[model samples]
Target: MSQLMSIDTFLDSEEVLVDVRTPSEFLKAHIPKALNIPLLTDQERAEVGTLYRHKGKEKAVLKGLDLVGPKMSDIVRSFLEVAPKRTVRLYCWRGGQRSQSVAWLLEQAGFKAKILKDGYKSFRRWVLNHFEREYQFRVLGGYTGVGKSDLLQILENKGAQVLDLEKEAHHRGSAFGGIGLPKQPSTQHYENKLAMRLRAFDMRLPIWLEDESRLVGKCAVPEFLFQQISRAQLFVVCRTIEERIVRLCQLYGVEQKQSLIDACMRIKKRLGLEHTKKAISLIEAGLLDEATLIILKYYDKKYQYSIDKRVVSLYLNGSEMSDVQLAERLLNR
Candidate 1:
């Protein structure tokens, strides 16, 4: 027999999750870690939907059965290959016939199945609602190359709750952020990942996050969470120009020179014609430190303006302390 479970109970269970939506639907967004065992190909789903619209539910049902009939054995086999135990959790777009049909088939094969109530739609609602609740956030603010991310890792190593937004977004929160990083997830997928991480930390404890603009690369922080980040107290870190230049060099030096030049050109208007040319020339010449220094002048001014708008809780001289020392100080305060 198959069971229908609420989103919370479904998520909390140890059973492996299987998504039975079309491949296109699964690609758009899904619960993290759920295996995609698409019930229909994209074309097939479109055909069924078109039939449902033009002919009616009865014809569509027959068409769907005709499409799924030969694939039933493959579907069960696919699940068997991935299933660690005899129990599994399944979901579709809206707790519709697809998931129900899959669950019934798996049950007949001697497997226990649980379905997500309201399917992936319910999980999305849960994710969006999660951002509305309050969380204790400690926003780390600094100009470019102040080692903010490095310090956050240190803080986490020492047992402080940290939410690495840039890591989640696969971006460094700069024009050059995507130079050598993996392709970023869609904004919907990004939110799903962020919400999952946010859920792991205790609401009562401070969750440290790097100060970010509304958009991190291509991903927008969910509005409610972004508002919370905007209002939270900021702990700013500062470093001298020379120290910052060295840090930036260390971070981007290994990336291809052309990639660095392309990144600089992306902000040409803001960086100004002469500055952009000079930075590109410096990068091609392999003077990464000098190139970074030129870039920082523009970034510093922009960051200072943003900092002025925030209510800073404190400022620490990053140049004077080790990352570990800074982490310790933030935790102690």
Candidate 2:
């Protein structure tokens, strides 16, 4: 028989985490490092769920068996191919039938597969609760195009514990944030990734993170983490508007003319229709610098409004130093 492993034991072990949930479920959110080897396909799970609703428990079980039984030997063989040492850690959505069945089949095939207690939901709970703990946070705050993200990366290169949340969310936290990035993960999955990243750091040392509003594209920062960010030590980088506009154009100076116009259109209500029209026209005319100025007028004002709400602990004239120099100065102090 396969062994039943507690979440802690499974975590402490060296075995690979194999998720047995459907591909759709695994794609939405999953425990980090989990290799998905679904016991049932997406359609099969839906069919089984529909069967359970009206055909009674026994009928549902039989239907699930009918769907999965054909793939049993192939599944076991594929898992062994991933874990050649005959050891594996398995889980499903709620740690019920799917993982248990897979564990049994794997054990029958001479593999010592262990099922995670309470499955992925347990890990989700653990991560959600992880945000409640206190950690020393040093926030790098600045207006748009102030190069805060670049400085954060510099700090990381210099051995500082930095949490690049934009990197995590694949966004720069603006109307144009998602332009060049892949689709954002759901907020739940973002929290899961954030929690996993936090676990690697020593909380005693101040974690350097870029100041972010709660929403990054579609992903929202967890409430506890957001509260921490709101109250953390702030390092505001002060740079000139002209300099910031130069940097913004450098960061977003892409050849995708339509994309740039569409991104600007997203904030048309806030930017005003006249301003938006002018910006789009400038972009169409190959005048990115002029278009950049128009957009920055709106973004800068909006960012200033947000900054006005926060207490600035310190403001550093970032124009005086390179990003690496700024990073070193901030960390050394």
How many backbone collisions does model 1 have? Answer: 0
Give TM per candidate: 0.98, 0.95
TM-score of 2: 0.95
lDDT of 2 by residue, 207-293 (tens): 999988889989999988999999988999989988998898887786488989999999999999999999999999988889988
Q: What is the lDDT of residue 112 in candidate 1?
A: 97
Candidate 1 TM-score over all chains jointly: 0.98
| Candidate whose TM-score is highest | 1
How many collisions between residues are there in candidate 2? Answer: 0
Error of 2 at 266 (Å): 0.1
